[model samples]
Structure formats: C-alpha cells, structure tokens
Target: MFATATRNFVDEVDRGGLLIPVRSLNDSIALLTVVVSQKGFWFWQKPKHVPTDFTLNDILTGDIPITPVLSETDFIKYNGIYGDSIQGSMDATFIHSNMNAAGKDSSKLELSFGSLKKDEVDVRQLLRDTKNSVLDMSHSLIKQTQKKRQVFGLVKERIVTSQPCSVTEEVQQADQCGGTLGFCGPKSPKVSLKDNGSLSKDSNVTMEIPTNTTIAYALIDLEVKHDGHYELCLMSNKGGFEVDSRTQKGLLGVTGAVSNNPDDVSRLAQELKDLSDHFQLLSALPASSKASLLKIVTDVTEDRAALGALQSVLNRMLVEKSANIADVSEAHKQSIQPVLEMLKESECGSVAETECSASLLSALHLITSALDELTHESLSALRACRSPAVLKITQLLVHCLCESGESPASATNVGVLSEDVLANLEHLFTSSDVNLQRDGDAATIQIKQLQKPGNRPLIMFIALRGLHSLAQGV
Candidate 1:
C-alpha cells in the first residue's frame, strides 16, 4: 500500500510539478509553492540570474520556456534554506516563463509591481507583528522551569520550543520593531493574565537543541543570575558541541514569553530587542533584496536568531564589497526612511537607529556618489542583492554625484550651477555663521578689496552672476 502511494505521489508530482518551465530568474512557481505546500513540489532551477526589471512570477502565470538551471553556488544557497528538495506528487498545470529574454526584457517589478510591493509590505508587517508580540509579553520571569537541564545535541537538529508569556493588552506601538514598554526589569515586570494565558508564574519552557549541545553541556560550569521569575541565561561549550539557554525559547529574548499559562515574560524583552535589530538591517538593505530578506527575517524572527543571520549578511556586503547606499532604488530608500525618523522622534537612545541616522543617509549618498564616480571606470558582472542588508547598502548610494553617476559628457554641465541651487544655498552666507577661521584667516569666504567698498565686492567662491541670484532674490 505504501509503495503504491509512493508511486502515485511520484507520478502526480512529475505530472504536475514539471508542467510549466520558464526562464524565471526569481521563479514564480516557488512563490506559489510558499503559500501552498500542502503536498510537495520540485524546483530544479535556482535564481542565479539577476533580472533587469522583470520577475519570473509573471511568466509562470503565462506560457513560457523552462528557466535554465541556476549556477552551482546559488543553487546550493537558495536550496539549502528555502527548498525542501524532496520528491512528492501533486497534479497541476506547469508553466514556464519566456516573456523575459535572458538579456532583453522589461523589469518584472514594473509589470506586477502590485504583487511585488505587496510582498514587501507583507514582510514589513510580519516584522512589525513579531516585534509587537515579543514586547507585549510580560517582562517577568518563569519562577519554575523543568530542571532536567533539558539537552539535545547533534550536528543538525533544532531544539524547538514554545512557551506561554504574559503581557499587557495595552501595548505601545513602537517603530518598525513594533510595540514595547519601558525597560523591563527582570525583578518585577508588568504582567496581565487576561491577555496572555499560555504562561503561568511557574511557566514550563521546553527547549530543543542539536546533539552538539549535548556535548557542550558536559564541558564547563556556568553562572546565572535570577530576579524573581526570570532565570538568568547561560552559555557553555563542551568538546564537540555547545549549550545555550539564552535563546528566545530559553529565557533571554522572550520577556514574558511562556506557554499558555497566563504569566511568563522571561525572554520576551530580549526577543523584541533582537527583532528590532533585524528590521534595523532590513531598513538598511536595497529595495530589491529587501523583499527576499524580509522573508528570511520573518522566518528567523519567530525563532529569535534573525540578528545573527542579518549581521552575517551585513558583514558580507559592507566589508566584502564596500557597497554604499546609492546602489539601490527609491523603493528601498522609502523603506528605511521611516525607521530613521522614528528613532529620533521616539528619543530612544537605546535604539541602534540613533547611531546610524546621519551616517546611514550619508552612506547612501556616498555610494550613489561612488557609483557616479565609477561609471567610467569599468563594469563587471552584476550580482544583485538578495537580502535586506544588500538592499539597504545599495539604496543609500543612489543620490551621490560621483564618477559612477552622470558624466560631464552625458549632455553638458554648461549651466553648472543652476539658479535653484543658488537659491537654496543662499542662507549659508546670511546665517550669521561668521565666515571666520580660528586662525583669523578669511574663514568661510575669501574677499578682496575691490576698487572700493561701494563697488561690487569680489568674492573668491561666489561669482558675480551667482551672487546676483542670491542678492536679487533677497
């Protein structure tokens, strides 16, 4: 019976899975599968190609050719994470995208932008929801946790866990990281049982771990601090493995997080903190990869490991390529702008955005300037961003006037300084910011004794024509 079912499954998947093939860089079939993975599906191709403006999603809905196989690297990366890479059966119409030629095609983002934008919005919302959930959790501790020193270890296995946590129904909606309260004191946290029931004062947390952790557990002794319900978190490493109880599932990230027992806020606060960090990275990435990273962030966020992964991506982009913000689009620019504003408005010095504010935007401009600077140097194969970190770095660089940007020969810089520019900068001269150097040398501007004081004063920086605009406007 099982053998027959297996055969049926293979035949069904083979019939339905391979139905439509196309040249989709971001294979749309995968998108559909993400929503509907009731059965199983096979995706032989990977997204090795960075499409111009097009997406493969549109092609899958229509008739198209089979998308070529992905490069070995991408195939491994994309598959290692999202793809299940198993065989199963489901009868359905197969479609492959062809509308987009390998090199010549309109942008997919342009065609089905509604869906793409919606996908991004959904990611943003998911991030918000995850954060809010953690913050709303009570800031207390779990007075009691089963102390068998729960352990699991192996090279590959998630020590999954879920517990109840308490929280006030009235949660203050924060920025992208979402709702939160003032700093939660582990000694005493705000708890409301009616809102959260999965946790109790003596909440029981079930932690899952890989076998490697089992080895770590055997190694060293660790110290822990406790304040009321929240037990202190501990980390240690043994010979072949490591042990960590600070995971959200442990008592670190989830403050009031607990089972449905009504009141438990052990790791919830930490969970919210980590969540905020993930969005920090998200808001920094380019618009293109912002969507992809949004998906990954949403998944890892639930587990509270998003920051680790996000930081890895950031290191890759910033250190590896020295990529700046100007590389991405306005779409990405809009995405991070809010978080920056929120940090200042909320006066959350604790927030990382505070430190990254001006620098982030400046970096964006710097990169754009760099791109403008490098435009004439030389071009190479383009590796598009696939993560939020990549998106943020690229987006920040688009605004600069660098060699990589518009060239003098593109048209003409004859009207080098436009009237508009002059008008905007006029205040610089009149702002009472004495143009003086500490050394008493001509500070802001160098002025010469023109024939006489009443005569037109000749300034070193501004020309008479440039001055005319500023003076006349005043």
Candidate 2:
C-alpha cells in the first residue's frame, strides 16, 4: 500500500506540484532543503530548494531562500520520496513547525564514529611516547650487551703507557755495584736578607734542580723451567754440596689431579683405590679402634672443612697402606719456608726447632696407631737409618701439621730402638730375605747424616711412624 501511494504521489507531483501557502513558502522550502541535505542527496546535485549561497545554519534555521524554479513548482519531488507525506498533511504551517521540532530533537541525538576523545590521539604526545620507548629499548640493549660480556669474561683491551719521563737509561751489570760516583765541588753559600733574623719583603725565589737525577730500567726476565725432577736449592752455614739431594718422581699423592703425567694419574687412581679400601677397613675394624681414630682426627684440627681436606691427605699418607710416595721431602721444606715465616708472625714469635719434638712424635703416633707393634719397631729402626720412605712421610706430616690451627699434643715418648729389635731386623737384611737381598748378599744399611738445616730427627721420627702404617706389610 505504501509503495502504491509513493508511486501515485510521485506521478501526481511530476504532473502538477503541490501548492504551499505564500506565508509558509520559505519555511516549507527550508524544511525541504534540510531533508534533502540530511538524506545526502544534495552532495551530488545542488537541489533548487537549497541555494548555492545558503549555508547549513540558514537551512537548519528555516531561513534559506528558495530558487525561482523551486518557487514556481512549490518544491521538487525530493527524488519522489516524502512527497506524499507533505501532500497529505492537513496544515502547511503545522507540517513546517513539526519538521523544525523534529530537527531540534534529532540535534540532541549526538552520533559518534569512535569512542576515543580528540586529545587521546594527539600527535605530539604520541611522538614523545614513541621516542621515550625507543630510548628505553636502546638502554636495555646496552645493559644486556654488557651483561653478556661479563658472563663471557670478556675484557676490553686498554693501552697501558708508562709515566712521562724526561730521561731514561738502559741498566748494565756493572751498575749493580753502585753507579759511578760524582764528586761535588764546594760552593759559596747564598747571602739572604733574613740572615739578620728580621722580617723582609716577600720575594719569589727559584729552586735549583739536581744535576745527578737519573732514571734507569733493568731488563730482567726470570724464566722458570720445569723438568721431571724437582730441585730444592738451600743455603746453609756449612755448604750447598754437603747434603745428598735425590731427583723426585711423580706428583704429590694428594695433588696428583693437577699433574699431566700418565704415571701420576695411575698412581693417583691407585692411591684413591687404596684410600677407599682403608675406609672400608675402618668400617670393618673394631668399634674401639674406630673411636680412637675418630678422636685422633677430631683432635688434629677444629675446623671441620680443613679437617675434611686434611683427613683425605693424611689418609693417603698415613692410614692407606701402599701409598704412592713422591720424593717431596726437600721439596716441602723449600716450599713451606713461606708458611713457616707466616707462622713466625704469630704471638709465639717462632716455633722451637727440635730434633724430635714430643708434639710431633705424638701426632705421628696418633696417625700411625693402626699399625702393629712389630711394624713400629721396624719403623724406629728405619728412622735411625734415615730411610727415604720415612723422609717422605715426615714431609707430609709437616704439611698436615701446618694445616692444623692448634699445636699438636706435647705428651709423647719417642723411645729409642732396642738392640734386640735391631738384631731381629737383621734377618730381613740377610740373604734369606729374597726381596731385600736381590743379589743373594746381606743388604748393607747406608746411614748418611744430612747437615740440612732444621729438625732432621723430627722428620725421621714422623716419617718413620707414618711409613709403618702406609707401607704394605711393613
């Protein structure tokens, strides 16, 4: 019905336009202009009802002028739509009033395309935000780069230059005996106005530079050479050649991991195996023995961490039988001189040097308590003769002693070897003992007294006790 009515209205308006009252003509034309403009049809075709000179405000106010053609036809068909509505209305003025009222009501219906306010998309603020974010990212990247360098232990190389100097001279060997002396001739004393012990006017006085000022550099590079043999150079009151020095083999049993030699590694493995066996033996030993061992270990050092480390080293040297002995006797004495110097820094001033200190003997007894009585007697005999095995053991004992914070027990009886025990020890030296008498002759015991400084007797005693337990079937 609506389509039929719209078509009929369009046909009628095309034949003869609907007449509006002269009084309501301009209002009718303005209302029609608003409708046309609101429908967006005036964008393509400039409607005759809306004049080129008419602004949107004029149209909305119902004050725009109608073209002559639009006035003649009352109004164009408005694309043949809404024509019937206006034509069918009862009052022209009422229609105009209603249209204006509807337009005002529609003006209150605020339409928006997006939710964001105008200030939200401000270009200046957006640019500043973007710039700040970029700077932050660059700083973060720089920090990450520095972190990576630190993690990789990368050190930036820097050019190191010596201090600026006016003079330099290469040193010579003869200059070590004090450089050539220069004789200074007598000079006349300068006469000062203040020599009369009175105040005088201040005057700038220049200082004279010394004529003998010299800067010299000695080019000396001490290259340390490593050979298979360990050498300990010692200075004594007697002579350097007085003591017999032997070439050391393998690594210090406890420090074998640092050695590159395959033999050292093999020895270290064997030592470790022996250590494991010793622990197993300890576990199997009587409870009393274990208690005694524990007490001795606890008494050795108060520091638990140092105790653990010392226990491992001591076990390899004392508890574990068949330890791979390195000839670190003289080596230790040379190396530990610094430690002894440090020890001298203590309030005690210096540790008393004795041939066989009771404290050292007590420590040795505690370490070698696992050995049999017969072995102890044999060890005493070996000590008397100054055996290398005993010497090595003594070096290890000194190392362990240094590791301990407290002084060892001073109560001990390092008794001399009995004649009977020595006589009984002779059987091993006889041809009957195949191991000792390899050439089928009595083994001669060579006793060379080393004039080496320090307590030789103490070294022999400690090493003897340790060797008793450490040597296989001693």
Q: After superposition, how far is residue 319 of candidate 1 from its true place, in Å?
A: 19
What is the C-alpha lDDT profile of model 2 across 200-299, one tens digit per residue? Answer: 2222222221221111100111111122111111121110111122675322211001222212223323333333433333344333323333333323
Lowest-sum lDDT 10-residue window in model 2: 100-109
Model 1 poorest ten-residue lDDT run: 109-118
Candidate No. with top lDDT:
2
Predicted candidate 1 versus true structure: per-residue lDDT over 241-274, tens digit per residue: 0224465233221111122210112222233233
The global Cα lDDT (0 to 1) of model 1 is 0.21
Model 1 TM-score is 0.15
